[model samples]
Target: MNLSIRWKVTLATLFALACGFAMAGFLAERSLERQELAQSHRNLDVRTEMVAHELRPWLRAHAPRFTDPAFQVLVRELGAKALARITLIAPDGLVLADSAVASEHLPGVENHRTRPEVEQALAQGDGSDLRASQTTGERTLYHAILLTEQDGSPSIVLRLGLPIVTLEEELSQLRRHLVLAFGSAFLVAVGLSILLARSLTKPLSDMAAAARRLADGDAAARIQITSRDEAGLLGETLNRMADELRAKIEEVSEDRSQLLAMLTSMVEGVMVLDYRGRVLQVNPALERMFNVTRAEARGRKFSDVFGHPQLALLVSTVLSTRVGQEDEILLSPSSRCLHIEASVAGGEQENEACAVLVFHDITELRRLEKIRKDFVANVSHELRTPLTSIKGYVEALLDGGKDDPDTSAKFLDIILKQSDRLNLILEDLLQLSKIESGQVLLRREPLQIEMIVERTMAMMRPLAGKKGHRLVENIPSGLPLVNGDEERLGQVLSNLLDNAIKYTPEGGSITVAARHVAPGGSPAGGKSESLEISVADTGIGIPESDRPRVFERFYRVDKARSREMGGTGLGLAIVRHIVEGHGGQVWVEGNRPCGSRFVVRLPVQPSDQAAGHPSLVPTK
Candidate 1:
C-alpha cells in the first residue's frame, strides 16, 4: 500500500513495540510457568519424602504382595496425602500396588521394569520423569524413590506423579494479570510513538516541501530549524544547499543572458543542434539570416532548416567524428555566401553531443576577392593592347618599312598615337588610384556649378564638334553654390562629357543640366540640401543591368567599342571617386528613347570627405 513516511514510521514503531512486548510477555510467562513447575516439584519432593519416611517401616516389616487390596489401599492413602498418583513395584518387575488402578486392574498392569521412573529408581536410588501415565492415560510429572533397609538392601520402589493441568491452571491466572499490565503499557507506548513520529516527520515534510519549492525555482523557500538534532542538521544543510543552488542558478542565468546578448548582437549566425540533428537553440542573428523565427526553427531538423545537403553532411561529420569541421555554403536567391564552422558541443559519449554551427557571411569578402582578380586581368589586357600596337608599329619601322619614308612616317605616327593612348590610360589610372587611396586632397570652396559645367562643355566642345554632336547647357541661373574642389568638380564634368562625346552618335544631343535640390530628410533625423547635376546623351544607352557597376574601375558596357574609340575605362571610375570624396552619391539611369543619364548628387555643404577627395575640408 502507498503510505507517507509519517504513517509508515509510526506503523513500524508500533509493530516493533508490539513484538517486543509480546516477546517479553512470552518470556515472563515461560519463566513464571517454569518457576511454578519448580515449586510444584519441591512440593512433590517433600510430600514423597514424608510418604517414603512413613512407608519405610511398613516396607521393612511386610513382604511385597502382588494385587493385594491392603497394598493398594496403602498406596491410595499415600497418594491422597501426597496429592499425587502412587505406585509400588517389586524388584522383579512386578507392580504390587497402584493408587490410580483398581485392585483387579493392578494384577493386569504393565510391567514396571521397563518404565523410565521405575528403572531409574531401581538403579539410581531416585529419579523424576514428566510424561503421560501409561496406566491412567493422564499427563503426569513423576518423581520416584527406592526404599532401602539399614543394610542397604532395596525394599520397595515408590513412584509419585502430579497432573500437569494443576500447574497450568495457576499459570493461567498469572497470564491474566500480565495481559492487563501489558495492555496499559502498550497504550502508553502507542501515544508516545505517535508524538515522536509527528515530531520527526513534520520536519521531514517541511524539508520535502521546501525541496519541491527549490526544484520549482522558488529561491525564497527555507526550512525553520527548531533543534540541533539530526533532523535539524538536515534542515540546516538543506537551507545552505538552497542558498548555494540559488546563487549558482543566478550566476548561470546571468551567464546565459550574456551569451544570448552576444549571440543576438553578433553578425555571424549561430545554431545549436542535438545528436539527432534537431535544432535546439537559434539566436536572433540566425533567425534573421535564415528569415525564420526562432520558435519555428527550434526542434526542426538541420537539413530541413538550411535545406543544404553539404552543410547537413558537414554537421553530421562533426557529430560522428567528434571533431570540428568548416565549409563555405552559398545561399541561393540572394546569392549570399556563408562560412559555417561546426563542432561537437557536449561530452564525448555517443549521442550526447550536439553540433554547434556558426555561420559567418563572407559574401562581401568573396566579391572583393573576385573584383581584385578581375582588376588584375583587366589591367593586363588593357595595358597589353596598346603595348602590342606600339610594338607592332615600331617593329614594322625597324623591318624595312622604315626604308619607305611614307610607310615609316605613318608607322611612327601610329606608334606615337599608341604611346599617347598608353600614357593617357596610365595617367587616368594614376588619378583614379590617387582618388581611391585618399592621396588627393580636394579644395573646399563655395563654387558655382554653372561655371564648372560651362568650363567642362567649353573644353570638350571641339571634341564634340568633331563627332558632329550638339552640346546643350541646362544650368538655371542663380543656382546654389556647391561646396567642393573646383579642379575635382571640373574633372567630374569633363569625364561625363568625354564619355558622352565618345559614345554618342554623330549629330546626337549631349546635355549637361544642374539644379539646386531641396533638403531631403536624412536618416539621422536631420535635413540637408544637395545640388543635382545630370549628363544626358542621345547615344547608345547603357543597359539597366550594367548601370549599377559602370562606375566601377575598368568596367565598360561595350568593351571592344570603348577600346576602339581610345576611351580608357578609368574615366568614370575617377569621376565617381571624386564625386563621392565630397560625400555625394552618383548613379546612372536610362535617358529614355536612345541614351543613358549619369546623375551626381552632392550636398550643398561639404561633408566628412568629398571622398572625391577624402582629405578635403569645408570652408564657410
Candidate 2:
C-alpha cells in the first residue's frame, strides 16, 4: 500500500494524458456533432430550395391553383426524401399547399408574413431554425426560401420544416460511442499509471532500504540498478555516494582505532580538552597515569581535575592562538610532578570546536635528575668536611702544637685519621662513578665462593667478637664454583658483612651461608647449577616500605645511624651492580624474630665456556 515515487510520477503523467485526451475527445466529438447538425441543416435547406423551384413556376402560372394536386405530389416527394414537412405559403402568408393533410381540410393560415423564417425568405431568399409550427404545433427546424420568376422578382415563400427528433437520434448514437470509449480509456490509464509508477519507484525503494542499512552502521549496503534513464542515473549516483561514504567512514574509524592504540601503548599519558577546557576523551594509559577513572576524567573541567591554574592557563593560551605549546605541569594533589609537552590541534574544526592536550609522565626522569644534583652536592659536602678537618689538624701542628709531645701526637693522629677518611671517600666516589659510567669491567675468573666469604668474615670477626655477637660460616663444603670477579665478589660479601656487624646489637648472631641451587635459571644451561649465597643477621630489619629502594645510590634507610657508623650509603648499590654483572640477582628479606637476610644468586659458569677450570672450587 506504500506508493513509490515512480508510481506517483507515472500516475501523475498518465492522469494528465488521460485528462487531455478526454478533453480533446469530448471537444472533437462535440465539434463533429455540430458539423453533422450543420450538414443536415444544409441538406434540408438545399432540398427546400428544390421544392420551392418546383412549385414556384406552377404558382406563377396560376395563383388560384395554389392547392393543386401537382403541388401536393411534389411536396410529398420532397418530404419523403428530405425527412421533413414542406408547406407552400402564399405571398399573403396563407398556407396554400400542405403535403401531410388534405389541402382543403388544412385551415388557411393568416399572419404567415409575421413568421421570422417566412419574413427572412421573402426579404433575403433563405432562412432556417428550430421552431414550433404555427398551425401544427410540432417542433421543427424551419428552412424557408423565396420563389422568384425568371425576371428575379419575389413571389411565394417556400418554408421547409424538419422535425428535431432526427438530429436528436443521431446525437444519442454518438453519445453512446463516447461513453464506451471513455470507459475503456479510464481502465487503460489506471493500469498504465500503476505499472509506470511501480517501475520508477522500485529503485527508489531499494535505495531507501540501503540508506536505512547504512544508517544502522552497515557500510556494505548498496542498491543494484542497471538502466540508462534518469532513474537509473539516480540509482548509480546513490550507490556511488554510499560507497564513498562507506570509504570515508571506514578511514575515519581506522584512524581513530590507530590513534587509540597509540595512546594506550604510550608510556606517557595524554588528555584532550574541548574549547571549553573540559576533558572530552581519555585513554587507558592516561587513566592509569593520572590514577583516575574514565568517568572521573570525563565532563570535568581542566582546572577542577588538575587543580592547577598554570595548566589551565596554558591550555587556554594554546587554544586562543591556535598553536602548539609545551610546559611542565605539576599534579601536586596527586603527589606527582610531571614534565608535560602539549600541542593545540583541530582548533578550527568548523566552529572553533576543540583542542588536544598531551601529557608525558617524566616523574622518574625528574627524580633521577634530582638524584644527580644531590649526588654532586653530597659529594662536595662529604669531601669538604674531611678536607676541613685535615686542614685544621695540619694548621694546629704547624702553629707549634707539634713541639708538645702528647699534643703533637694527638694532632698528627687526627690528621692521619682525616686523611684516611678522605681517601676512603674518594675511593668510594671513584668506584661508584666507574660503575655508573660502565667504565669498570669485571675480570671474570673461576673463584671459590666459600674462600671469599671466610676471608671477609675473618676480617669482620674481630669486630663481631668485640661486640660479643656470634659470626657463623655455613658454606656447604661441596658448593659449585661460581663464575665471577673474585675481588668484586669479595667486596660484595665484605659490604654485607660490615653492615650486619654495624647494625646488629651486642650478642646478636651473623651467619654466612652458600649452596649450589638449580642452574636452570643460570646462563650455564644444560648443567643445573646456581650459587645461593646469603648473609643473615639478628639485627633491626629494614621497613617493608624502604626495602624496594635499598639499592639506590646514597640512599640510607637509617640516615643518622649510617652516618654515625661511617657509612657512605653506596655499599648496596655497588653490591647490586656487581651481582647483576655476574648474571645474578640480589634481594633482601626479613629474617624471623627481628633480623634481616640479604640473598644473592649467581650462575655457576658462562654457557658459552667449558664447564671446568683450574683454581675453581669443584663440586664434591
Candidate 3:
C-alpha cells in the first residue's frame, strides 16, 4: 500500500522490459516464419520447374494418348519422390496422364483446362497455385508450364504439385524454437530491469529520507550518494540549501537572544511600535516604569499605555519624519518624570518603518535642581536682610550719632544684635549643610530621655518666662534610655521648645513628655524598643497642609513671624536630618484645640534594662 520508490520504479521498469521483449519476440517470430515460408515456396517452384522440364518431351510425344503405359511410366518417373502428383494435359482440354492414378482410371479424371494453374500456364508459359486437390483431397502447391512441340505449336501443359504438410511441419519446429529463445531473453531482461530500477531509485530514496530529516529539524542530515547523475546533483543542491537555511536560522536566533538580553538588562525603559502606532515590544524596565505588565501593554496603542499626550506626539513625529526626537514627560499618580527619546528604527523600508522609544526617569534630578535654586535664593535674602540692618546702624553711627554718647551706644547695640543674628544664620546654615551632606559624626551612647528633656527645657525656660508662656515637662520616670548623641538630642529638644516659646501667645503653655514604645508601635519597626518624645504647644498652630513639609530646608509656615522672632528656618530641617541619621523619625501633628505638636521617635538602646514604666503619659 505504501510502496517505496524503489519498488515502484522496479515494477515500472519490469513492465516496460516485458513489453519490449514481447514486441521484439513477436517481430522475430513473424520474420522467421516469413523467411521459412519464402524458402519453402522457392523450393516448390524449383522442384516444379525440374518436373516440367522432364515431362516436356514426353508431353509432346503422347499429346492425346494419356492412357499409354509408357507415357504413365515417364510421368511417374518424372514425379519421383519429390512431387505428390504429376499430370499432362492435351491442347483439347482433356486429361492426358496423372501420376497420382492408374492409367485405366485416368480417363475418369476431371478436365484440366479449367484448372487455375493450367489456365495460367496456357496464358503466361508458367504459373503456380496452393489449393486442395480435387483428385486426392490433399492440400497442395501446384505449378504448371506450357509445353511446345518440336513443330513450334502449342501442344500440352505440364503440371506438377506437392503436398505442403512437410513444409508446415518444418515451420512449426522453427516457431517452437523461437518461442523458447524469446522466453529466455524475456527472463534475462526482467532481471536486468530490477537492477536498473534499484540503481535509479536508491539515491532518490536516500534524498527523500534526508529531506524528511531536514523537515524534522535535523540540520546535519545529508545524502551520501556518490553518483554523477541528476539524482546525485539534486542531492548536493539540497544539502547546500539546508546548510544555508540552518546558518540563517541560527544567526537570527542568536541575534534575537542578544537583543532580549540587552533590553532586559538596561535600566532605561524601552518600547517599540509599528508604523500603525501599535506596540510591538515592551521591555521590563518600561513595564515597571509605566506600571504596566507586558500582557496589558503589548498590542495596545502607545498613547494608551503611557497616557501622555506629549509622548504620543513624539512617537507620531518620529514616525512621520523618520527622525529622532526627545522630550521630558511626567506620568501621573506616581508623578515620575521621564526623559523620553524616540527614533525611527533604521534598516527598514518606508512601508515597514517602526519607532523606538526610551524612557529615562529624571524625577530626582529635577527635585535637586529645584532645591539648589531655592537654597541660593533663600540664603541670599537671609544674608541681605542682616547685612542691610548692620550697614544702616553703622552708617547712623558714622553720620554724627557718635557725637552723643547715648545715641552712639544704642546704634552700636543695634549693630551687635544684627551681627549676632547674621552669625546665628551662618552657623545654622553650616550645621544644616554638614548634616545633610553626611559630614556630621555622632558619638552614640545610651542616655536618659528625661534628663535630655529637662536640660533642653531649662535652657528654654528663661525665653518662655520672658514671653509669659508656661513650659512644663511630663517625662515619666524609669523611661528607657535611647541610643543617640546626647548633645544632638539636647539640641533637638531645645529647637522645639524655643520655637514653641516664640510662636505661642504669652498665656499659652508648652509640654514636653516621653514614653517607651514597642516595635511596630512606631515607624522603626525592626527595633526591639523605642522612645517617643512629644513637644506639644498651645501656639499659633501650623496648618494641617504645611505639616508634612515643616522639616524641609527653609520651609516656614509664617516666614515674616519667624524672621521677626529672630528664628532661622533651618532648625526643624536640621532636627529631621539628625533624627533620621540616628535611625529615628520626626513628624508634626495638630495640637489639641490650637498650635502644633512635634513627635520624635528614636530606637531605644539594647543594653538598657526595662523599668516597667507605663507607656501612656498623663496630660498636663
Q: Tell me, what's the RMSD of every candidate?
A: 4.6, 7.5, 9.0
For each candidate, give its TM-score against the true structure.
0.84, 0.66, 0.67
**Which residue pairs show collisions in model 2?**
6-197, 7-197, 519-529
Better of 1 and 3 by lDDT: 1
lDDT of each: 0.84, 0.78, 0.82
lDDT of 2 at 322: 72
Tens-digit per-residue lDDT, 399-505, candidate 3: 89999999999988888888999999999999887777777777666688888787788888888888788888897788877766888888888888888888999
Shift in Å, residue 442, candidate 1: 4.6
Model 2's C-alpha root-mean-square deviation from the true structure amounts to 7.5
TM-score of 3: 0.67
Error of 2 at 430 (Å): 3.1
The lDDT, on a scale of 0 to 1, for candidate 1 is 0.84
Per residue, candidate 2 scores C-alpha lDDT tens digits across 428-514 of 878877876777777767677888987888888888899999999897786767777788899999999989999998999999988
Ranking by TM-score: 1, 3, 2
Number of backbone-clashing residue pairs for each candidate, in the order shown: 8, 3, 1
On the 0 to 100 scale, the lDDT of residue 446 in model 3 is: 64
Could you give candidate 1's per-residue lDDT for residues 157-258 as a string of tens digits? 888888888777767887888789888988998898889899989999999999988888789999999999999999999999889988999999999999
Among the numbered candidates, top TM-score falls to 1
Error of 2 at 504 (Å): 5.9
